[model samples]
Target: MSNKAQVLVIDDEPQIRKLLEITLESNGYEVSLAATAKEGIIIAANHPPDAIILDLGLPDESGHEVLIKLREWYINPVIILSVQSNEDDIVKALDNGANDYLVKPFRTGELLARIRSSLRIKISEENNPLITCGEMEFNLSARIVKKNNIIIKLTATEYTLISLMVKNEGKVLTHQYLLREVWGPGYINQSQYLRVFIAQLRKKIENDANHPEYIITESGVGYRFVCKE
Candidate 1:
């Protein structure tokens, strides 16, 4: 396959490896398969695939360990392909670094769609330079966030959550969606985490954090990043 995009498929099962390789390749993506997490890491370091399709169960090192290693350095769209359907497993994968996930037996079409969405997000983010809301300015390129020209320090997770919300500014983001996208799927039930982060962000950007004019809450659902009309 050529021109679709390079994808690295890491799975310990030979049959599974062949299945994914054939599917991705036939669909026009160049695919590389690794049977072990160690090999996957080496391939990722050396080749730098455009995206990753990783199976959570590996023969040598577990997928979580591989994800941690990748998160320590690499930053690309990663989709987890796993038989582990447990909520904890999914959440752990998302929190560790996966951009998307698929449980075993996922249809080829669904997998491809997810991969495209992930890539689309990465490309869109790369193209974004700056976003402004009233006196607040968010510079994605510089990774700096400011209000009234005063720089504010946002924790890594805070920045992630803010960016996610800002990208969907003016749209009502559901609590489940926001928590899953930013923190992880397991965190959807953890509204307090979202509240704390939003409170912190509001304090830094809004004149009154308690009032929270910039980050507006939409009842019990989620929040909206207020934008100038």
Candidate 2:
């Protein structure tokens, strides 16, 4: 197999596909193009790529439907590159298992960065199971969490939230993503629930809940788990 990371670009627009092909190929990546959702799905199923750039609009089928079908078996990153700028669309895409959402007219630099970030997280998860930050340690295989070498108690929801964040450490997980993953798809709009649980989680894990170092809130966007030592 070629060492170059492969990327599938699924878009109805020929120009967009061509542009992504050039950009991705120049960045030392292998590129595949599909002009419709059906074609994209077939290509993806036949030859899985390291990552996917999916457009939300397609001629035959909605890209959201395509994403749902892909997530049934496709484990790699799928970034939404769409013209929809509304929050609901973005949230819906992320809730449907998209790794990241980037509206159309995106900066090439930012798009590349998002791809790298997604790939990095996927690789790290496959290779490592024991995650540690500061005095906190998480043994994913055992579902055990320790702080300062002492066992700590957490509610089921709290544990789920923490594990999700830790798994996506060093990446900004949007409110929609976290809510969907932890509370399910129906609760995507319930940001206050996340706030309450996050507060409780911080109290249990952080040395100082007043100034958390582990979970950093991204203001209006979401929260990120900072695990860098």
TM-score of each: 0.60, 0.69
lDDT of each: 0.81, 0.88
What residue pairs are clashing in model 2? none
Q: Over 4 Å off in model 1, which ranges? A: 1-3, 127-229
TM-score of 2: 0.69
How much is the lDDT of residue 62 in candidate 2?
Answer: 90
| lDDT of candidate 1 over 1-229, digit per residue (tens) | 3466899999999998899988988888899989999899999999899999988888798888898889888798888887946656766777677876777888988687777767766776655779887898999878899888889999999999888878756544666778888889789889888888888888877888878776877554457675655
lDDT of 2 at 52: 94
What lDDT score goes with residue 65 in model 2?
Answer: 96
